[model samples]
Structure formats: structure tokens, C-alpha cells
Target: MSGLAAGWASGAQGRTARSPGIAVTIDDFDLTDTPLMSGEERDAAIRAALARHRVKAAGFVAGKYVGDSLDPAVLARWSDGGHILGNHSFSHRYFGGEDPAGFMADVLKCEPLLSGYAGFRRLFRFPYLAEGKIAAGRDTMRALLKRHGYRNAPVTIDTSDWYVDNRLKARLLADPRQSMEPYRRFYLGHVWERATFYDGLAQSLFGHSIDHTILLHHRLTTGLFLDDMLAMFEERGWRLVDADKALASPLLAREPEGLPAGQSLVWALAKADGRYEGRLRYPGEDGAYEAPRMDALGL
Candidate 1:
């Protein structure tokens, strides 16, 4: 077995005794694309939230969105304030079904844009968590990333913030006066639910909580509610830590055997384990847990 696999095997014998902490990573900086909040407004809100929480996060940029809808100044704001920046692919294309060569090229396309940012880290998070449909595509990308000095920014806590944003946006558009209380409750509940679920998975796999890298987006929901989200996490006993430190968890190094290997690395590793078969959730992105609750709340 590879060293990483061997380490994982050894670690699996018992969980490490450590406190829970999380680093937030935001992807696809399309802040200007939203009509709900002006670019400046979104920037101010995000800045305020980070300051209020006294935390820093890593933002991944989609190169194509740079001049189209994403403002370069916005990225500067985050990096300047001690947050990190990384590539989110050039065009947010799914690696699955994509030509590995072209995908590598796309990733390279974003390096120029991100390389100058403060705290710019050599990290890359797969768009849509779709690594590849098969081993060749997945393996080729891994090799390319290694050759290019990039590390996979694997997520541990993956929630459906984007879907909730969509539902919230539709509601806002239909009635400007509609109460957001239900949306807020549903959003917080959904995130807490995912956190609990993934924490359980980590405990089962490693015998203790592993530092988590949370996958959230640069969207309206986050810009408006991130402070509350951070507060909720703290209330739940999860400390907010630096993105670089969180990604350093030994759990992130293990590339378990799996096809289209791009979900939370934790989920992928769990799925790759034969013992976890029939016990894990497939396509871990659905809103089935929150949909019914939101619908019942008349949201």
C-alpha cells in the first residue's frame, strides 16, 4: 500500500484525540452576478462578517468569471485581509467527462490570475466535486496537479447552500415582503445536519473528529448569513481555523480507491472502504433532508 494508504489504515485503528475545528473555503467568486446585492454591498457584508467573526477563509476563483462578473478588487479584499486564494478551475467545468488535457489547461489558465493574490495557496478544488468519470481522467488530473505544484482542496463538510440560495432567491423574487425567518431556520438547520452527519462519518472512520474543510459558495446566502453560520458552528463546539491548517489533516492525504473520486475526501474514503458499503449516502449533494422541512415550513 502507498504510504498515505498505510497511514490511513493505521489511523483507522483509533481516532485521534483532538478538538473539532473547521476552515471555510468559498468557491466561484461570482459576487457581481447577483441582483439581490450589489457587488459593493456583497463585499462590505463579507468583510463585516469576517471581521465580526475574527476569522479568515480561502476563496477560489473561476478564471473566466474574472472580467465577466467577478471583480478583481473583491478578490483583493479577501486576500488583503489575510485570507487565502486558490484556483477553482478557469471555467468551473466538471472534470467528469472532460478531457484531462483540456482540464489541466483550464486549471493552468487560472494560475496567472491567482498567483499574485496575498496568501495565494497552491490549492485546487474540483468544480462540482466531479473529479472524473473514470480512473484515467482522475489519475491524469492528479498527476497534472502534482506536476503543477497544486494540492487538492478536499472538502469534508459539504452542504447544499447553493440549492437553498436558489429557493430563497425564488421566494424573494415572488414576494419582496416575505419573511426570511423560515429560510434562515432552514438554512442553519441544514448546515447543522450536514455537519452532524459528516462528523459521525469521521468518528466512524478515524475514531475521532478530523479537522474539516467546509465547502460553501460565494453566494447571497453566504454573504448575508456567514456570521450567523460561524456563530452556529462555535455554539456547536467547532472552532474556526485557518484554511491551510485545516487542509493539513492527515485524513486529507489519503486517496482511497474509487471512480469519479470527487466528493468530500472523507466521503470518498468512506465509500472506498468495503465495510462502508450500503451505509453511505451516494451523490452526497442532494437536498432531500432540507426540502421536506422547508416545504413544511411553507418556505
Candidate 2:
């Protein structure tokens, strides 16, 4: 086995005791208006929540969402608020079916906008968490990122916050005066469930908890309840770490030999281990998986 693979095998024997840690990483600086809030209002709300909690997050910028207009101001607020910004690709295309060369160009295209920010980092997150479907495409993209001095920002705790936000928006449009408590309840519960599950999976595979990066998006749900979400983690004894510190975990740098290359890093590592098949699910977290449950609950 390769050194990294061996290290993973050795750690899987027993669980190591440690406190859980997580950092918030928001994606897609989509400045489009939503049902409940205007684009600028949504941006202000998210930044306000972060400031209120004194938490520094990493916002991944999708070039397509940003333009010559008010978009730069929206991103400027994030950087000025002590948050880090990373590239999420210009077109935000799924790398799985994309040509490697084209995808690299897309990633490069987004860097200029972020470079002006003091908080910008040479971190790149795969759009949709889909790295590539084949080994060649994956390796090619990896080389491009490495060549550009960019590290792949792997998410460990993945949640479908965007999906929940969609549902909440739909509800609000149907009746703006309706109670938002149910949406809050569902969002918090969904996040906690994914957080614990991924944390447990990491513990089982690594024998300890690694600093986790939870995937969240810039949306109405997040803008409305990010403070609550951060508080929820703290109340549950999970340490809220900075995105820079969380992404610094050495484990996040290790490449798993799993095919179709990406999802949550923890999920990929578990797949490469070949022992957690029964507990694993393809496409780790998705709206489809939560739809029935949400529907059943009338959420």
C-alpha cells in the first residue's frame, strides 16, 4: 500500500478520543435575488450573522455569479468582514463530465476577481463536489491546481443547505406570513445529522476527529439562520475553528484512490479503505435523499 493508504489503515484499528471541530465554508457568491430577500439584503444578512458570531468563514466565488456590476461589492463585504475567499470556478461547471483543460481555464478565470481581496487564498473547491469521473481527468485537474499553487479544499461535513433554502423560499412565496420556525428546525436538524455522521465516519477511519469543513451555501436559509447554526455547534460541544485552520489538517491534503474522485473527503477516504461499504452512500448528501423526509414532515 502507498504511505498515505497505510497510514489510514493503521489509524482504523481504534478510535482516538478528541473534541470535534468544524469550520464554515460557504459556496457560490450568487448575488441573485430570492423570494424572501433581495440580493444585497441577503449578502448583508449573511455577513451580519458572521460578524455577530465573530466567526470567520471561507466564501467560494463562482465567476459566473460575479460580474462588473454590484457583484464585486458583495464579495468585497465578505473579505472586509475577515472572511477568506476561494475559487469555485468561473462557469461553476461540474468537473465530472468536463474536459480537464477547459475546467482548469474556468478555475483560472475566477482567480483575478479574488486576487484583489486581502482574504483570498489559493484554495479551490470543486463545483458540486464532482472532481472527475475518470482517473486521467482527476489527476489532470489535480496537477493543474497544484501547478497554480492552489490546494484542493475538501469538505468533510456536507449538508444540503441549498435544498432546504429552496424549500423555505417556496414556503415563503406561498405565504410570506407563515412561521419560519419549521424551516429553521429542519435546517438545523439536517446540518447536525450530517455533521455527526461525517464526524463519526472520520473517527472510524482516522481513529480521531480531524478539523472538519462543513459545506454551506450563500442563500436565504443561511442568511436567516447562520448565527443559530454556529450556536448549535457550540452548544453541542463542537469547537468552531477558522476556515484556514480547518483546511490546514494534513488529512485534507491526502489523496484518496477512489474512482469518480470526489464528494466529501471523509467519504472518499472511507471508500478507498474498502471496509465501510455498508455505511457509505454515493453522492454523499443530496436534496433527493432529504426530499421524502421533508415532504413527509410537510416541511
Candidate 2 per-residue C-alpha lDDT over 103-149 given as tens digits, one digit per residue, 9 for 90 to 100: 89889999998999998999999999998889988988898889989
Any residue pairs clashing in model 1, and if so which?
15-207
Q: What lDDT would candidate 2 get against the real structure?
A: 0.85
The candidate 2 region of ten consecutive residues with least summed lDDT is: 1-10
TM-score of 1: 0.90
Q: lDDT tens digits, residues 72-181, model 1?
A: 78878888899889889998987784588899899999899888886788889899988888888888888889998998889998989998988888888888787767
lDDT (0-100) at residue 137 of candidate 1? Answer: 80
User: What's model 2's lDDT at 33?
Assistant: 85
Count of backbone collisions in candidate 2: 0
Q: TM-score, each model? A: 0.90, 0.92
For model 2, the stretches where C-alpha displacement exceeds 4 angstroms are: 1-17, 68-70
